[model samples]
Target: MSFSLFRASVRRAATAPRAQLRSQLRIPLRKFSTPPPEAPVPTPKSNTTLYVGIGAVVAAAGVAFYSFSDSGSNAVKTGVQAAKVKANFVPTKEDYQKVYSRIAGIFDDAGDYDDGSYAPIILRLAWHSSGTYDKESKTGGSNYATMRFAPESQHGANAGLNVARDLMENIKKEFSWISYGDLWTLGGVAAVQEMNGPKIPWRPGRVDGVQTQATPDGRLPDASQGSDHLRKIFGRMGFNDQEIVALSGGHAVGRCHSNRSGFDGPWTFSPTTMTNDFFKLLFDEKWVWKKWNGPKQLEDKGTQSLMMLPTDYVLVQDKIFKKHARAYADDEALFFKDFAASCAKLFELGVPTEQWVSPEPWIMKNVDEK
Candidate 1:
């Protein structure tokens, strides 16, 4: 009986009521073989936030640098204190005229220097100084007053300019601020206008320069050469046929000294006034070769009194150049305008940008006005 009862009890224990066995094991019925879901890792979003913060810091730094640089540049530009110019520093048309009169006075007093007057050579000085510009390269212009320097002052074409410059020194003593660049150009204008030429629109922007700025002397036209040589030389300085003819009109005022350019006499009868006489004489006169021991310059066959350089003769020979010369011969006004414009440009070569006042052109008056 005991064995049977024990066996029954063991069976009852082994296969006890499921609820009772669950309670004893303390395990839930749903906990069979499924795996538990993992808790999500806490990945940070800080990488993107860090990048944005760094970018903002870099942008702020860049803005700060640009502001500093611009302010420094502005300070430099404004530092000249150009505002402090003295009351007497201001110019008047009369002042310009005085300068012109001074130049004219020198021309009148030609008996003071070499071979009588130095007016002709002074004209050459202004011509050579301005004739070296090349527009394409922007290398030359009256801006720098480079003719004050050595190689430029010593140029063969400029051989006699020193005498003229020396003569003008007296005028400089009276008006120290007017740069030599301005004086040379103004002198040319004065000589032309007083001689009955058109009123040139002159200005005073060229600053006097040191010897280092003097341009090489050969920059001017060679009186002994033909049209091809003239073109090459003037072309280097940026003159077209029209400009060349206009510039040649300067011959209307001054004479070609036998001792200077090796040609003798003035082209026009009235060598002191600006006129169409140069073209008139070129067209009206019968130009024959001068038979002197001097260079091969042309002489007026009718009078045997006036002369023309080979370069001057080419003006009539070239069809294009001849057209303007004939026009100027007929109309003094056109010659005046052209000569003034071209000559003004010539005087401004190599000028510095900063020294330029407003970059606008102004009229320069003669001495009577001063």
Candidate 2:
């Protein structure tokens, strides 16, 4: 306890191994503890364990620095970005509504296109894409969006649909996650709703399929064909007489082009709007063979400007078909109801039931709907 003794004790403590001093102080040693000199220095065998412990601590410190430090943040951010890339994208109804809004915005942007609205042709694209479904083979239809490929795109019935496909491609770019099948079918739904037509219930589930899945040509109805052909084409699609008459009312909007279907002219006076007019005009008009070089289409003797395809005329000529057509022509509300139901079925033709995002299809709201 004397000054000289205390000085000697302090010198010994300082000179002794720091581990021994720490033990005297009752301090706990961690995993990488240093032994007192009298315990014998660690051998090369033990040095391996000591070096591994030091390396592990250094590695843990480096990870913490990378996670928290500004300079190391870029690496951390890159890892997060990679994780995001790997995660699957699932779109909600709101997401699909944004896509619908974009499609609706473009419908009226057509400068000189038919009726000054892209709605008709866009609807046609949707129809032709889905109409290819043959229930027997279970091939084609909107499920694959095979119209994006060859052979099918060049099918006679699909002529001029390129305009619609190209227009929808812009939408696909904005919503890169949406499948082409969903995009084209949704495009059809948008066209109908925007043109003051019936609401088509829709949901997204179609995935793109390979080109080899495309249906054979002539699956779509030939405009020049008569009632039996109509029965055959639509009947193959699983439609009964009433569904056939209702679906044909889609002609109430779009026209036949000589350059496209080899028949030219609009089915109704208002080609831009959806109405019972197609059925009405078919009954009201005096349709005679057109005096044209292109094909055997009928022009109304009254106007000469408006025309009808043989297929359109047959809805009135065939007795069974005439009954349904008469009902649609007499009652606009009935036409709207039938068309909405049939078109919804048409759009969803080849899509598997399991692929549907919901058990019940969503009624996508129109742009004007609050």
Candidate 3:
């Protein structure tokens, strides 16, 4: 009744239920080993529930997206609209002519400015704003109205440019369609032309860019720099020997302020006039090192009132620059032509070829001429 019966019971359990238990384990293994049965292909009759379930998921996703994205969506839409408004605006040449004449009317009434005119400083605004261009990176320049950003405005080179910019702001209010780049540059042109200088062929269509697009400081030529540095800075702008000589003629107008440029005094006797006088002075005068508590600069030996940047002195020291400088000095007409071309080039720097307001620049008639 003990061992024999126990053995018989074990054999019965193994043969009968044990095989079934093994079969059950194998069934699970085989089920996993093979692919589970294909999901039943949705039948037309069954698709209603399936479609309803899918539609519910999609609708929920749509609601979630709309709720979360509302602010961002509105921002994008507003930005696009603002861009469109800017794009559609096309100020006529006549409208610009009005701006050109109006800017000519703004002179130094306060007697607080240099040369008894805001014209010189106004010209410098165009100069500094457009001067930031790098033909390589195509950054800087007036295209961004970049001086409006503090980073460019704070640069020592651009120190007093706010006076120029603020003067133009009055004009900006009247002609809202005009970009600051165009206004400032046009002001430069008008200053030259109205001051009895050459006709600066001008155009518009510089779009305002943001602060991220602002060029880093020191791109403008340091008055402290020599010929080699001038070559590196201006050459980067694609200016040639003749162009550099011509551009220096802008010194004919503006004065260097100790508070602004850290160098004080006018370049020529007539700081109000843009002329070959700068070239004449560059060649004909004696420039002695200025002895001052301020930054190092050169004073005209005969008259300590005038100043010359080292970069300016380089024009004569470098033979290539001297030739053009002498040529511009010899012929006032030639100086006017080259200076006009250089001003046009400087204003156009960093502007994409396609972005110009005109295919060929306009020779805006001076108020007297008009």
Candidate 4:
């Protein structure tokens, strides 16, 4: 055969075999004895997707923080000012008159308490409680209501005060919000005003006390005692001679009962009304030593109705104190104004200066009027 023809013939043989193999493989065949090796399973890709997701979250947080910082400066918060005074805690003149009106209702008729009695004793209770205040340690003031306790209630000066406290319980129920200290003091003010005394400037904030808070015994004055003893006792409470005389003006309302103070009778003719009479009687009335079986007390020589305690005699005899007493007797307005101011100061003796919201006076209303 020719060389070109032979080469072409060899190529045809090889190509012919490839085509035949392709055609034979195209026919479907089930392997009975042996299965073809399974295609190699692809290995799992490393967890790149999870890491990408975490990165996106971190980027979002970073963006948020930057946004807050880039915002305008935060507004400065205003702070409260120190040494700032709020407002006055004191009530007005109308408040006092209101309280007086209520007390009047309690005794509208002439015969109110045991045929027009008991009011004077109630006034005495208030005076004794507040009168115990000492400015030195700021203790024993109306702030504590300590009289509700034992030693204080049993005090000789405070005798028969329970009657006043018990009587006040009804008024307390009517004015539940008022503190015992406020109620008692305000009661005195109201009693005096209702009885025709000067207006007393008052403030509330006296706390009520439990039975254990009563004051020590012998804190009060004895009616039989002289000027020296009176000064010592009242002085312990931080009272001046002027304050002593002014506070004694409280006697204008109440009387000495034979059963109570052991010396019997009222200081003034008009016991219910507040007056200069206490001073007037001290100077004008001829006080004679009483001829009595009980205790040594003075009786008015003229009427024989008015009474004088040993302490009362000191007013006329003591030069320093007598000045204030005499001045009060001479001038009605001066006594009224001085008495009102001093009484207000006496009631607030132990209260801290800082705690006082207002230094001004609070005129309380009559419970009945409210």
Number of clashes recorded per candidate: 34, 0, 0, 6
- Our tally of clashes for model 4 stands at 6
Model 3: lDDT equals 0.66
Candidate 4 Cα RMSD (Å): 45.8
Candidate 2 yields a Cα-based lDDT of 0.69
Of candidate 4, the 10-residue stretch with the lowest lDDT total is 1-10
Candidates' lDDT values, in order? 0.56, 0.69, 0.66, 0.56
lDDT of 4 by residue, 200-249 (tens): 78765454433434566665676677778778877887778887888776
**Which residue pairs in model 3 clash with each other?**
none
Model 4 clash pairs are 91-362, 95-364, 98-366, 99-365, 99-366, 149-214
In candidate 2, what are the lDDT values of residues 1-370, reduced to their tens digit? 0000000001111123435634654533322111211211223222233333323332343344345443344334323322322342235666677788888888766655654567777787888888889999898788868787778888767777778888988877666556678888998898888767888889776755555577888788877778888788888889888998898888776666656566665666666667788889888989899887987878889868767777778788889989999999899999999999999999899987656666678899887676
**How well is each residue in 1-370 modelled by candidate 3, as lDDT tens digits?**
0000000001111112323533543421110011222322233232233333333332343344334433454233324424433343234566677788778777534253444567777777788787778877767777657777667778877776677778888877666545667888999898888666899888765765555567888777777777888777788888888888888887776667666666666676655556788889988898999998987778887757677777788899998989999999999999999889988989888876656645678889777663
Off by over 4 Å in 2: 1-86
My TM-score estimates for the predictions, one after another, are: 0.68, 0.77, 0.76, 0.68
Better of 1 and 3 by lDDT: 3
Give the Å error, residue 227, model 1.
Answer: 1.5
Measured by TM-score, the strongest candidate is: 2
TM-score of 3: 0.76
**Cα lDDT, model 4, residue 309:** 78
